[model samples]
Target: MLMKSSKLLKLKFKHQLLMLFMALLTGTTMVSAQELTINGTVVDESGVPLAGANIVEKNTTHGAQTDFDGNFSLKTSSNAVLVVSYFVSFPKNQTTFKTKK
Candidate 1:
């Protein structure tokens, strides 16, 4: 009886540890999905910054306008996919970018 009790306690401890590990893994995965930023630059055909260009994520409200130097930063999640909309010197252009999971 004593031997069996010890074995049961060990099994329970192992199960608890396994549960803890799985919880940690799930948390990490979700956090990674949440913490993501999409960064890019908008330049003209002559390699100059195109200020005031609109960078938008399609089907969502997240958006950012290009800075004076054509730099833009937009925060997003793992499921976010950007659809940039802007007008350059030539015409209207649309671009797509995906956030890393």
Candidate 2:
């Protein structure tokens, strides 16, 4: 009688521990939002592709450069801000709004 109760208590404790471990594992994997790929082309006001432009994720070291056709691709969070710059003469404060498909 007493022995059976003790065994049941131990089993319950083990089951609780297993559930806790699973929760922790799942929490870590779900802590971050899925990264998104942003593809765009840097163009001048005159509608010409600005090749060799720098596209940087604001406040982070992650960045990319435009190809000869002014095409660039970056992987970042959905709410990230990108800083684009070409030659020093280019206005660095030029702000572009995000577009959704």
Largest lDDT belongs to which candidate?
A: 2
Q: For every model shown, what is its TM-score relative to the native structure?
A: 0.54, 0.67
In model 2, what lDDT does residue 53 have?
97
Question: Model 1 over residues 1-101: C-alpha lDDT tens digits?
Answer: 99999999999999999999999999998887675687789887789987888876667788899989889998865566565555644565666545533
Q: Listing every candidate in turn, what is its Cα RMSD in Å to the true structure after a full C-alpha superposition?
A: 6.0, 3.8
Residue 5 displacement in candidate 2 (angstroms): 14
Report residue 84 deviation for candidate 1 (angstroms).
Answer: 2.8
TM-score (C-alpha) between model 1 and the true structure? 0.54
| Candidate 2, position 23, lDDT | 97
- Tens digits of per-residue lDDT, candidate 2, 11-42, equal 99999999999999898777554457789899
Candidate 1 lDDT for residue 83 = 57
Best by TM-score: 2
Q: Residue 82 of candidate 1: its Cα lDDT?
A: 63
- CA lDDT for candidate 1: 0.77
